[model samples]
Target: MSIREMSKKIVLCFLLTSCTYSINAQVKDSLSFIKSKKMSDDDLLKKREGTFATGLPDFSSDPVTGFGFGIRSNFYWNGERTNPLFAYTPYLAKLKANVAYYTSNARELILSLDVPYYKGTRWRFKIDFKAQQNPANLYFGSTESTVGNLRLPSDENTTFSTYAAFDKARKTLRPGGVGEAAFVTDALSNRFRETEYMLNLKADYALGNGKWRIMSGYEIQHLSYKTFEGEEADAINPITGEETSAPNGFSLLQRDYDQGKISGLEGGWISILQTALIFDTRDFEPDPTKGYYFEIANEYSSKYIGSQFDFNKLFIQARAYQKLPFGKRTVIAGRLGIGNIFGKNAPFFEFQDQWSPEGSINSLGGKQSLRGYRANRFLARSLWFTNVELRYRIAETKLGKQRFAFGVAPFFDAGTVRDEWQNLNFKNIKYSYGLGARVAWNQSTIISFDYGISKEDKLFYVGIGQAF
Candidate 1:
């Protein structure tokens, strides 16, 4: 229950349900409810008028269908801190739903449901699925902690350690066995225990007229755990402190009561067969103030084979956006990428390359990248990532029948972890920056919030749609 204590319990549940009711029966005096709901509030203050005489019709002359279902639940705690960067405090309650059907011949049909209840667990059904096509041409999902939550951050510089810096780095890498000790048997405790499950599938296509396009998918993960098993405690080296001797006499650190059970299952299957060459003249989606949306995406991934981890990659990701005419619906975006992630036996605590000796910040947070970081924190062979965002459109609503929108965004993220391809560029990058929000009711479901910061740490995100 962090995030400033769940934002002070969502502002004390919106000030106890908006201050115990009745500001004249739930506050309704918008010019007497727009003249008793007769509508036409001066054509909503005439925004260049044109809705066919305000009676409002012409739903684009056709096409309109959407269905939805949702639930999100989480209760958290990350106590036990000795300032190892504010140790422990991760809590959650998630509920989800989907029922979508769209037509204009572009076709689409989706049916989904998910329910999760942590802490004492018992809510079941994580996702039920079905699909058909084109619901805005891509950006369909199954939520991976809303997109990877191994706890975030990248380019390995390491942080988030307390419990006495992981009990003084497991007593300086395994000392005098009491079961080898790792996050316990000394300095501070609470090693590990985790549970996970995931599923995903998506599709995309838009050639020529779209300049070019092709996207694909497949994803899965199942992880059950118990951790910390070390080796090397036969010490005797001062300055160099080099001591070896852990052929299994002890050094199994944690996980050896019933020798910890179910400990493997990791999945990955992503296809971004790309082609993009957009030169948006700008009618929308390029708002800083007015225009800029030039895109180039040639991306690919194929080395995350499954259960216990596996990777084989190919990369190229690039993007850019603009719209900053001086506030009032602002916009600015950026993205860049280069990749090559390989694997063999995997499993170094889920493919470790760096970060996880107490580290985490923003490796785009899993499943395919940043929805608030945490999932596969750099298990490398090669990688490079970059991102930037700034969007604004604070408020607009008409509630009663529909039409509502709200927005806010601020972002900057970075990634790096290399071993080849000339050790990838950007001179070993690592970064983080954050703030996000959105509500878009009329557009049919969009509720998201993101908060990220670094100087140490800060990450808060709630989700439903649009982080892409």
Candidate 2:
């Protein structure tokens, strides 16, 4: 079965289990003579002041990364509600850690800490560190070329006859296609390996009442690439089917490096300094039901900052949430974002990332952007995208001291990338629509499952929090 099909079964099983648990809990409560106490709003506010922890086993499967397993944990300290800032932020202090391994020979380690209104001061400090290695990362060409390079099974060039011939050759030459050297090169030419380490430190100072803030940060990153090697197989003559000595060809990434189309092939360090202005009036930071968030950020990296190359990036984004009049628990959320990079000295890999005060959005495709496409499926110097979601709470219940909420979100996403601002056109835009399942834990953590489809691909994503 396809990966998307398998993911659907997984989600179905999870929902079934949750339903069973809810039924058992209800029966247990009915059998008990005494009812559980329901805390008032004031009591719940007091409960939020103490330290709390939550975590779950991370399980994920996708065509790009295969099956992945890990653990993610979050620790939070809300401080006293009387502190004045407690109501303005998600938490006074927070720490998050995640570690995972994938069947594709990929591994990841991440740690992050956030302290808003640090020590009763106006400054909010944040630090993040990550180390990741993936042997099967996707790497289509960048810029407008990516728009034309994408290939699917239905494409004219990938006819049945062509696929059959390729398959026959593979079976004859490699027999079972074992080992690194025996594996046939992907006809689509879109796979590579990447190892990366990153460190970032940021500080935000509340200007007035914490509704507006000035953000500044420093980041350092090191990245390396490993291109797939060509397959080594015994050649067979097409007509006679007789074996002969021959070699295949280089991987797509290797070919590009040889042609001098890519930089930082040997890997290097990048140092960057960034600043932004943020205006946030959201009712809640994690799952906002009403309000707006806006940010404009600029980043500069140069040799003077201890970087190997020089480049500049700019990003502008706005997000808003509103409750619908017909449904008491319905919310409409939307976001618009645009970004661009300047200078030709930047590495090709850097073009795949967009940055803001909140976090990084990796490319115009993937879970955070175009859910129907693969991660980093499209890369370019300029990009624009938008997302709209209609979220409706379907159910709510209390399990012990934890509050659980189940919701559904119907979403639409559209985006495109180009080599430059002038090259951008609405005619090239791509769009996808999907429905998502949401489970909110203690009104703080949100578990999300989304399935999206485009003309080119279908993808399912399991993640934390909303796509925005």
Candidate 3:
């Protein structure tokens, strides 16, 4: 059936099932999920009945002295056949909490934390915990992992080789996933449990004509795995033209057969010192809807003790926007930036190589780049990206005295992954284009959906705005 038809059926089922509920409960569960262009993590936590909290002062009532608090617990899952690379491992749950507050004086702070737990398909409980404070200039929080945020490298050959090896080993050991075999495979042995933490501080100091902002932080991680992923030698019966199988049905004879075994505690700490220079040329004070924002930041980090990675990076992003053709409503904006993950020699980590294109901007899906693919689908040493957008305001209204606004935009994005600094090529860059819809809960929060397209893929992405 068409998506519209499917949507109609879902709405019909929901209405028929809960037509008699109270307005608050109905809105919290059904209406919020359907009416909102995009659902927030906070909403998901509430649905799951977990504790959720926000440190931002409240501005819902009189705006100046208001404070708000919220808590919820929710779990998300994806099965293998649905999303190959992601589901190929196991279906896991994420326990999350979020809280935020904003004062009348314009100071705002938000806290969001996530803890991974439970194993849906595999026997191991592979969990990861992450917490971050937005507007880092305002509060403190953890640094996010590059795993999901950064894109990785990709080549058809490399993709086939790595995944094919994994698949072949899985089929040989599990053989159609029967009983115990279903829970045991080369894929399952590689699973591990890890914890990551970061503390971020961002603040702005205003002078007579412009604003000066500073962002600094530190991060640490602890990875403990029962067994690292490795294959055993393939056992073959030379006399019978057949392969030898072990008691567990694994191919017993193969080269470099490394069995997955629980390794002791392996952890590390990484700290970064960061500072940024910003030039703000606008009419308004601390907050202005229309203005030019420019930033150049330099961050340095030492190797993680008892870990295998080290790097220093320089990040820069600049933005400009101006009123456009349509009435007083439409606006056009553009952003350009360069980001590099550089190291003296090879990386300390084992999974990705410096030239690997798995999680850099050159990869398929990522923030400010492609929306059709998952973030960090590809990785690489260094990357570059550029974007432009045209937006039009659609509507403005108040919901029971709560103000909300909506808008639509068309955007073009370009980026790439590269090995050495000298290997960069902008003329042969990869690009994507899409249309987006955005809704503002208040001035501080907005949710967006982008229906993006590339020559080989088309995707509908939902997240917070803007892409940059």
TM-score for each predicted model, relative to the true structure? 0.25, 0.80, 0.51
- Please list the residue runs of candidate 3 whose C-alpha ends up more than 4 Å from where it truly belongs after superposition: 1-129, 132-194, 211-267, 282-289, 303-309, 345-364
| Residue-level lDDT tens digits of model 3 in 56-96 | 22224321123433332222232223222121111222222
- Candidate 2 lDDT over residue span 129-224, tens digit each: 999998666776666666553442112253222323543443343322333344333432356778999999999887755567899999999988
Better of 2 and 3 by lDDT: 2
Residue 162 displacement in candidate 2 (angstroms): 16
Q: Least accurate stretch of 10 residues (summed lDDT) in model 1?
A: 49-58
CA lDDT, every model vs. true structure: 0.37, 0.72, 0.40
Candidate with the greatest TM-score versus the true structure: 2
What is candidate 2's TM-score against the reference? 0.80
Q: Against the correct fold, how does model 1 do in TM-score?
A: 0.25
**lDDT string, candidate 1, 405-438, tens digits:** 6888878777756556575677635566777887
1 against 3, candidate with superior TM-score:
3
Segments of candidate 2 deviating more than 4 angstroms: 1-47, 61-67, 103-105, 152-183, 231-249
Model 3: per-residue Cα lDDT at residue 218: 36
